[model samples]
Target: MAQHWIATRPGDLEVFSFEPYDAPAPRSGEVTIEVRAAGMNPADAKHVARGRDEDFPRPIGYEVAGVVTAVGPDTEIGSGTVTVGDEVLAFRISGGWASEVTVAASAVFAKPASLSFAEAANLLLAATTAAEMLHVTGVGEGDTILVHGASGAVGVSVLQQAAMLGARAIGTASGSSFGVVERFGGTPVAYGDGLEQRVRDAAPDGVVAALDCVGTDEAVDVSLATVADRSRIVTIAAPDRAKDEGFIAIAGALPESQAYRDSVRADLVRLAGEGRLVVPVARTFALADAVEATELLMGAHPGGKLALEP
Candidate 1:
C-alpha cells in the first residue's frame, strides 16, 4: 500500500485528504517509481479546477523524483539508461503525489547528482516551458527579450535560458524580486503602471521578443508596445487574449505545446545534469502536508520552487 493526496473536487486544495492506495503495476513500456519528492505547481490545481466532469477524487501532482522499483515485461529495467534503485525524475504523470506511480518509460530521465531530490523534482516542467517559449518566439543573439513575472519558476528559467542563447533579458517583477532576476542574468524592471516606459529605458536597443508569464493585461499591452512583430511575442498565460489579440498563445493544454515539450524534454534534463541549469527550491513539504504546500503555491510566489517529499 502507498499514500497519495486527492481532491474530491476542484477549488478546494485545503480540503484534500491523504489516502492509502494499492501499489501501482507497470504495463508495457512503463515503470513503477517509489516517489521521493513531487513538484507543486499552480497548474496542478488549476487543471483540476477546469474539471473533466468525471475522474473524481483526482490525484494531484505533475512531476516527481524517485527510485525505479519495477518495470513492465520486455522493458529493460536493469539497463543503465534506467534501472531499479537508480534515482530518476519523471513528469506528466497522473497521481504523481502518491508514494508509488506508474509512468511511461519515455517520460523518465536520470536525475543529476548535483541536484537534491527536491530540486530534481521541480526541474522538468518549468525548464521545458521556458525552452518552448524561447523556441516559439525565436529568441537568440542580439535579441532583447522581455519576460514578465521574471521571479516565478518559469520566468526565471526563461531568463537563464535566454541568457544561454545570448539574448538580453529584460525581466519585470516587483522591486523586491529585482535581485532574483539579476541572478538569472536578466536586467530587472518593475512591473506596474508605466511598465512600458520602464522596459524601454532598460532596453534602449529595443525589445525584439516578449514572453509573458504573468498573463495580465498589463503584460500583454507592454509586450505589444515593445515588440512590433506579433510572432515574436507569446504568452503562456492569457489564452483568451492570445485568441482575440494577435500574439501567440502556447500552453501545455495545446497540441503544439505537447509536441514541443516531447522534443526538448530530454535536452533540458541533460543541461541540468551538466550544471548549466539551476532550479532554486524555496521549501519542501512532507507528502501528508501537501495541502499546506498547495496553499502556499496557490497563494503567492514562494521566492523559489516548492516540492513535496514522499
Candidate 2:
C-alpha cells in the first residue's frame, strides 16, 4: 500500500491526514510514479486552506520527481516515449504528495541527470511562472527588470531566468540574502524604507518591467513608482493590487497562463539538463511530515525551495 497526504476539509495543516491507498495501473495516456521527492509550493497549502466543501479529501501536492513504475500502452512523455524504471519528473499533477501516484502522461518529463530528485521535482512550477512573467511583460535582451522577493522560491527563479534572457534584474531582498540574489545574477537591493531609491541606484535610470513575488504594499508601490508602463508591471502574489491598480495578475489557473506555461516546460527542462538552470533546495522533510513541511513553506523564509521525500 502506498501512503499519501490529503486534506479532509478546507483548513490549514490541521486538516492533513495520511491514508493507505492502492495506486491503480496507468490507463491509456497515464503514468504511475514511485515518488522519490515531492515539490512543496505555497499553492499546495493555499488551495487546501481555502477550498470549498466539495474539494474535501483531495490530495495535497502538484509535482514530484520519481522513478516511473508503469506507463499506459504506447505512452509518450513530453519529450518522447516513457517506460518503467526511467527517472522522471512530473508537474501540474494531482496527488503528488504520495509514495506512489498515477498521473496523466502529458505531465511527465525526463529528469535531468544533473539535478537531484528534489531539485528536479521543484523546477517547472516556479520557473515556468517566471518565464511567463517575463513573456507577458516583453522582457528581452538588454532590458532591465525589477524583482521583489528575489530570495524566495519564485523570486529566485525570476532572477536566474531574467539573467538568461540577457536582462539585468534589480532584486529586492533582505540584507543577508543579498548573496542569493547576486549568485543568481541579480543586483540586490534591500527592502523596507527607501526601496524606490535603492532600485533607482541599482538600475540608474529605470526598469523596463517589474515582477512582484513578495506582493507587499511596498513592492506594489515601488513597482508603480518605477515602471511607467502599467502593462509591464506584473504580480503573481498580489491579485488584489493587480485588480485595484490596473496592472497584470496571472496564476497557473488562468487559461492563457496555463497554455503558455504548458508550452514552455520542455525548454525549461532542457535548460536544467544543460546545467544552465538551477533549483536550490533549502530543506527536505519526510513525506509523513507534510504538515510540518508546509508550515515551513508558509513561513515564507525557508531561504530556498523545500521538498518532501517519500
Highest-scoring model, lDDT:
2
* Highest TM-score against the true fold, candidate: 2
- Output the worst ten-in-a-row residue range by lDDT, candidate 1: 74-83
Candidate 2 lDDT over 68-116, as tens digits, reads: 9999998898779878999999988989999999999999999989999
Return model 2's CA RMSD, one decimal: 0.9
lDDT of 1 by residue, 71-158 (tens): 8876643223666788988876777888898888878888888888998899988988999999999998978899999999999999
RMSD vs true structure, all candidates? 1.6, 0.9
For model 2, give the 10-residue run with minimal summed lDDT. 294-303
Q: Which pairs clash in model 2? A: none
How far is 158's C-alpha from truth in model 2 (Å)? 1.0
